[model samples]
Structures are given as C-alpha cells and as structure tokens.
Target: MVSERSSKEFFAVTLRVWRQAGPSASGRFVDYPATNVSPDMSFLELLDVVNDGLTVKDEEPIAFAHDCREGICGTCSCTINGKPHGPGHGIATCQLYMRSFKDGDTIIVEPFRARAFPLVKDLVTDRSAFDRIQQAGGFISVRTGAAPDANSIPVPKDDADLAMDAATCIGCGACVAACKNASAMLFVAAKVSHLGLMPQGQPERDKRVLAMVQAMDEAGFGNCTNQYECSAVCPKLITHDFIARMNRDYVKALFKAKFKPVSSASGGAG
Candidate 1:
C-alpha cells in the first residue's frame, strides 16, 4: 500500500555526508539541507542538487561516484543511513528515490568501508581490488578459430540459469561493506560459479579457483564467517548458496591436486 504522505510533490531533508580531503586526511560528516526535493528525484540527483547549491556559493561540492544512473553499472555505490544502496530491497543506490524518506529526515551518507577498498575521496573508494581478483583467474581459455555455433555446447537448463544468476553481480563491493568481517567471499564465489558451472570452464576450473582465492587473500579481504550479511544487502539479491558451492569445489580441487596419479616415462604409474 502506498502512503499518501510519501506522494507529495516536494519535501526537505538533511544530508549528513562524510567529507574527506584525502585517504590520509581526517574525515567528518557535514550537514547540508536539501529543500524542495521532488519525490521522483533519484538519490544521485539529490546529490547533484546539493552540489549545485555548493557551487553557487563558491564552496567545494561533495565528492561521490556515479555512472549510467540506471542501477546496472553499480558505480553509484554508497551507504545511505547505514544501509548499502539505501532504503530499498534489490536496488542499487542509483535506484533509490527521495520518496523513501520523510520531510526533515536526517540521512547519513558514507562511502563503502573496507580495507581492500581504500578511501579515494568522500563517498568514493578504490575498488580496483575487485579487478585484480578477477584478473587472477576469472576466465576460460579457448583456441582462436572460427566462432562456435550457439548450440554447439549443450548446457543443462538449471546450470545455465544458475550461471546467469551468478553473472548478475556487478562487482560493486557492497558485499564487503555489508559483511561484519568485510569479507569478499560472495563476490569471489559468484565469479567462480558462473564459469565453473559451465562445460567450457572445466579445463581451468581447479586452477581458476586456486588463483582467485589466493589473490583475494593477498588483497587482504577477510574470510566469510557464515553471517550471510553479504547476500542481504546485495542489489541483485544473489543467494549465499553460491558461497557454499564454491567451498565444495575448492575442497574437491585441493583433493584432486594432492592425489592425482603421476605417470612414469615408461607409461606406467610412478
């Protein structure tokens, strides 16, 4: 049921945004009043309005990240009122609207906090760590030749569906922000499973998981403690089950690597 009060044309709210001059500099929250805010305005639009006001007054505008404003890019990452992507379910920050709040409400906005995602500026953090992890092994190698037909490979319906679900992760780093231990397992699991579930990924399955996991730990991300907060705040609503699947695959890979037989030059087991 829609509330009548939330449908009003415009309202006002206070934005308490964290302002940091640099990664090493001290930071604090500064309050800015947003007046006559339309209920239809997206959260990023609200920031733009506040920035316009600051520009008119010759003051520095708040720093934040945004792109494609349609919730697909996942570039507009921020914690609104202590919730990733703000007061919404299965939507990114760019999808959040001013109507979610009441007039005169105080909204606390901050950047995603995690050691792996270093602070770049106010409301923006360095997420290149994700790129690094992906580069470690999130791919399959195929010989260069004529493109294979779409139906050349037969994939089970269930596996294809699950692969697509895992592929929906936009690498936003929200999982790390939402986790109490700041873990990145959810993101890694999604990457691993989306490819691991497919026949094309079998050749490098064991190597991929091993390399990515090592890279994740090398990047200083914490391990998952099974709290499941990562899935709760996910904009795509990806289930935590992927994490378990990855764990099983990892164990199997380790066992296979340890016990695989070694053939002798004489064509007999060593």
Candidate 2:
C-alpha cells in the first residue's frame, strides 16, 4: 500500500524525459528540475507543470499522450524508471500519483519500446498495431435487429465473471513493453478470451483465434516464452492464464482446420 504524504508537504524531483522530433529523428534524455510538486499531483500533472515551464522559455514542450485522465483510456502510456505505467499495480500512467516517488528522485520517463509499437515523439508511441490486431478478430458479428434481453443468453456465473476481467484490457501495450521478448500474447489472449467465452462469439471462435494470432506475428511481436513478465506490469492486472486459454484455442482451431472438411469447418471447431 502507498503511504499518504501530508497535504501541505511538497517535494522536488528531476524529470528525465526523452525528447524526439519525429519517428526517424534522434532522441535523448533531457533533465528538468520539477519544484513545488504536491504529493496529490498526478504524474501527468507534473509533466504538465514541466511543459508549462518549457513553453514560457520559448522551448518546445515535452510530448506525451493522454485522454480521459481517468485510467479507463489507456492512451497515457509510458515507461517510468524502466517500469511500464510507473511504480504501481493496476494503475495506468495517468493514475500514478507524485506521492509514489520520494523527494530528490530522478524520474526517468520514456516511450514504450517495441517493434510493433513504434516511437512517435518523446513519450508517445504508435500503438495502432493493437488496432490492426483488434480489427483482425477481437469482435463478434451480431444481427442488426432489436436488442436481445440480457437473460435470454444465460451464461455461467464463473464464465461471466472471467469474461468481464478480460474485457478490462484497454489496449495499453504495456504488456509488450514489459516482456523481454516483446510478446503481445497477453493482449491477444485477453481479446480472444473475452469474446470467445461468450455464446455470441462461438460462431467465429476458431477464426478469431487464428486471425488474431497471425496478425500478432505479422505485426512483429515476438512469441511468448512464458516468462510471465507481460502480466507483471499490466495496468489492468490482467492475468497470464488468459494466454494459456488462447493457446489451447489456437491449437484446437488449427487441428480442426487441417483435418476437417472446409465446409464442415465453416461454423468453427469445438
């Protein structure tokens, strides 16, 4: 648990932020002193203060991504001192508070590094790779008609609860950043399982698993060796067990696709 600091207490830290002009431009860490920082201030808020100082000095301010300052939107992604989403569990960078650090700390901030998530500028990375992967499968087609009653499709309580856990993934790409192999298995698995477990998703389960895994490989993400680091830094606290579930689904799908008649495989394998 994080200990609370006094409301009147203020501290200072050296912000070591990465600076880059473009995708191909050179980049380096530039340090700036952040003074009069309140413990209650969010990490992004501290960056805002630093940027304000830079703007006033006729210097280009730091670039970082953020939306819906609440942790719901995973747009605010960055590495702080080599940890994805900074020093906290189940919290995105936007949700990290200044109190997590000590006074006089040198905070190192940089973009999430991975071949799939190319760096844009400073702390921003192009995480649209996740979008492409999602577009490949991460959904179920529904008939365009009146909405069905919730109780019409009764799901087991256990399955419903597990599906909701997987659905919490916000596509932050923190898993890719945290893994030594830069594997996106956890992200793909969560996407696959959340929908695959539902009755509506059964029709395309095999297809979805195959397509998403293929897309993940094509996006240049490495294979998961099961080091389990991906789950270690996930802001959503998504478990690695989802990866196992996805792997089983992929194997079953592949086996059926190879042996079953094409016509018979249309509705997907068990």
Candidate 3:
C-alpha cells in the first residue's frame, strides 16, 4: 500500500452517505465529493476526510460507528455499494480500501437495515439488541479456581476447531443486514454452537440454547428462511452449518421436555 504522505497521486470519488436525523426521521442519500483521496487510505479514512470537509463548512459531520480500524472490533460495519464490508469476502468494513474502487466511482454507504437495529443517526444503528441476546445465555457458569492445564480436559480436535470457528463471530450484525428476512439465526447459532460444543459448556447446554433463542425472538429479529444470506456477508465467514446444528438442538430439547415423566408423590398417613 502506497502512503498518501509519500505519494503525490490522489484520486477523486463520490460518496453517497445516508443521512437520518434520528430513528423516526426520514433518511436520504447525501452526495459529497471526496477529492484528492489517497488510494492507500482505508474506507473509514476516506469518510474522515469527507467529514472534515463537512465540519469546515459548518455542517454536521456524518455519524458512524468505528472502533479498532484493524477489523477485529467489528464496529466498522456499513453496507457499502450494496454489500457488507464493501466488495470483499471474509473481511470487515475497516479492511476495505479506496483502491478497491476506481477513480470517480460512486460509493453508496448505508446502515444495516433490520427491524432490531434501529437507526440512531446517519450511518449508526443501535446494535445493542445483539448485546442483550448475548447476555441471555452466551456464557458458561463455572467456579473460579487456579488455572488448569490446557490438556486437562480431553476434547476432540474437530470439536475444538469448530468451536473456535464459531467463536470467531464478532456480532457485527452484518448477517442480519444481509438476510432478506433480517434473520439473526446465523448469529445466534454461532453463539449457541460455540459454547454447546465444549465440555465446559455441557452443564448448561440445553438451557443455554433455549434461552438464547428466546432472547433473539424477543429482540424482534425475523426468522431464517434458509437463504444463507447471513453467512454470505459475515466478516468472520461463520458457516451456516451452525444454524442446522442449533435447530437440531432446539428440536431435541422440545422432544425431551415432551417425554420427561412428571414425578408424583402420595402423602401417606396424613
């Protein structure tokens, strides 16, 4: 990547930013010319330049969420050019670069469209629904004690690998945005499978899955139609396989509840 500080070459592009005053306010696309944009600059950096121009003109800068431009924080989420993370596979929005677009290209930026993710401002949405869903059952309760050896508990290599894969989900809500129904099954499934596959997670496996699914429903997210759009835009590349696994678990739990015999006691000598 060539540095703008060292290179004299700068290109121009147009940014179609979505502007919404508030959650209930009607939104519109506002075009801003980004002149002298360095090809080496990240997508967020380009926005920074545009915002600086807006600020200089005594205009409100575009409000967007970004934290760790290194692509790990998962906060730099935006629907770029009709794709999450901007025309890339297995990468977050922060990982997108200006070079990905040609000079004079028009880039459309918008927030993740979902009922659960209400618009907070221009490009920022209240994604706290994910946090609430996580809080429901995304944990394993265990006594805190001295650190145990890594191999103390025997775990199959495949299960460990799958758990790690599922754990890679950063809860960015990209899956929700990409789904036609705005389903969060992929996200919830990832969280459920990540813990359900591990030995430490065994104690609360049944309770965890049921609670998390209920929380997700209460969050106003739609149901999965098996379109697999959620997996397509996931920055972590979380597979849809977890969704099937979670469905199986949920069905099994239902059957278990239906068949469990109720205990009856008789008071003798009363």
Candidate 4:
C-alpha cells in the first residue's frame, strides 16, 4: 500500500461498489465517480455522494447499511478497498477517509461475504447469525431483579483484562470477511472468552461454547485454518489466541457436556 499525496482535486475518486439486490441475487461491482469530495469527508459521506449521483441518473443506488455514521455501531460494516474496515488499524470503514485515496483512484467496496453473513442487500448482510449464536447462551442467566453492585464479585484483574479484551468485539464481522475460508473463529472465540473469564458466566459454562460452536458450524461458516487472517483484520484486533483458548474451552466442554464437537475437515472451526 503506497501513500498517495496531493492537496488538490481529491474528488473524482473512482468507486467500484458491489451491488446486490437481495438474498437470492448475485452482486456485481459498479463504477461511480466521487465528484466534489473533500479529503476530510468520511468514507460513507463520500459514498452518499455517489449514491446521490446514481439516484439522479435514475439508476438504483447502492444500498449500504449505516447508522450513527460513527464507528461504534459496528453496523457500518463493509470490506473497503479489499481491507476489512478499510485501510488502517482498529478502525471501522465509516471512520475511513477519502484522503486514503487520491483522484482517479479506484476503490472497491463489498459486503462481508460469509455463509453465515448471507447477503441481505448491496453492502448489508444478515449478521443475525452471530446474534443467534449469542442467544444460544453467551450470557449469564440471572433473573432481572438480581442486580448486584459493579464489584459484587471480585474478578481477578488478569481475568478481567482478558474478559475486557474479548468483550471489545463490536460484532463487525470483519474477522469472518477477512478469512480465506470465511471462518467466524475470532467472533465466536471472543464471545466464548468474554463469558468464560467471569464467575457470573459459570452457570452455562461449558454448554455455552459447545452450543455456540455448533451453531457456528451449522450456519455454514468455515473452520479456522490457523492462517490468522481473521485476527489480522479484526476491527477490535482480537487475536487468534482467543481461538486457541476457545478450543481448550470446547475440549473441556466435550467432556462436561458428554457430547463431542464434530471435527470436520479443518479441525472443527479452530
């Protein structure tokens, strides 16, 4: 990745955006120009211009999901210019800048393509598969009225730090998108670790990892090959180490639950 330097005519970027109509529809890249774009404009704002251009041309505008236009929602997920969350460390695509490109640069944007992420529209995919995995018991099942003080339970600082690291997952799906096999290893492991680190998550304990991993497999997500690409592009910068931890948890879960996780071609989702 070479740095492009210019202070003039930053607009006129060539955008190659994937256009998908629906779940059953196959998508293709379409070119649109980013006219009058300023360097300071957020990447999505620049896309807004492009969409407006297409709408004026009476062509269907490319539909990309975004809200709060801030990076935190994790909903503004897109694979920008072949990089998940665009060109930088730990930044969402919405936080990317037009300055990352120069005039006449061709930018490619696409939805997160994973079997788990079934394309819902142009740049929006159904990530509820992740939600389902969470619902499969990623939580501590305490009745609502059982509110305890923030420090009710004393979690060791080391464990707390690790849990916080795992909890940093924004559910952006970048890990799934970046992997060659579209493995959701990082995402699943984060959830597993986030819960496994604390005492509150003890009730479900072994069952949580087992069930979530099973759901991940059934959702058609590929197994992690240890290539580490998923962790590399993760917006939260979650590491493959979490996957290793998850495997250990899963192995423990197998004995505790009395049900073994099915080992497929790639060693059962890493």
Write the residue-wise lDDT of candidate 4 on 31-136 in tens digits.
8767777777789988888788789999888888788766777888889878788887878888887777777788899998888888888998889988988888
Stretches of candidate 4 exceeding 4 Å from the true structure: 1-9, 259-270
Estimated TM-score for each candidate: 0.95, 0.95, 0.93, 0.89
lDDT of candidate 1 over 1-270, digit per residue (tens): 344555557899999999998999999999999999988888899999999999999998998989988878879889999888888999999988888888899999999999999998899999999999999999999989999999899999999999999999998888999999889999999999999999999999999998899999999999899999999999999999999999999999989988989766786565
TM-score computed on alpha carbons, candidate 4: 0.89
Q: What are the Cα lDDT values of the candidates?
A: 0.92, 0.94, 0.91, 0.85
Task: TM-score winner between 2 and 4, please give it.
Answer: 2
Off by over 4 Å in 2: 1-3, 262-270
Candidate order by decreasing TM-score: 2, 1, 3, 4
**Per-residue CA lDDT of candidate 2, range 1-270, in tens?**
354788579989999999999999999999999999999999999999999999999999999999998999889998999999999988999999999999999999989999999988999999999999999999999888999986999899898899999999999999999999999999999999999988889999999999999999999999899999889999899999999999999999999889986564556566
Query: Against the true structure, whose TM-score is highest?
Result: 2
Report the Cα lDDT for candidate 4: 0.85
- For candidate 3, the 10 contiguous residues with the lowest summed lDDT are 1-10
lDDT of 3 by residue, 63-174 (tens): 9999998888889879999887789888899988887887889999999998999999999999999999899999999778988887999999999999999999998999
Clashes of each: 0, 0, 0, 0
Quality of model 1 by C-alpha lDDT: 0.92
Best candidate, lDDT-wise?
2
Worst 10 residues of 4 by lDDT: 1-10
What lDDT does candidate 4 reach at residue 135?
Answer: 85
Q: With candidate 1 superimposed using the best TM-score fit, by how many Å does residue 102's alpha carbon deviate from the native?
A: 0.6
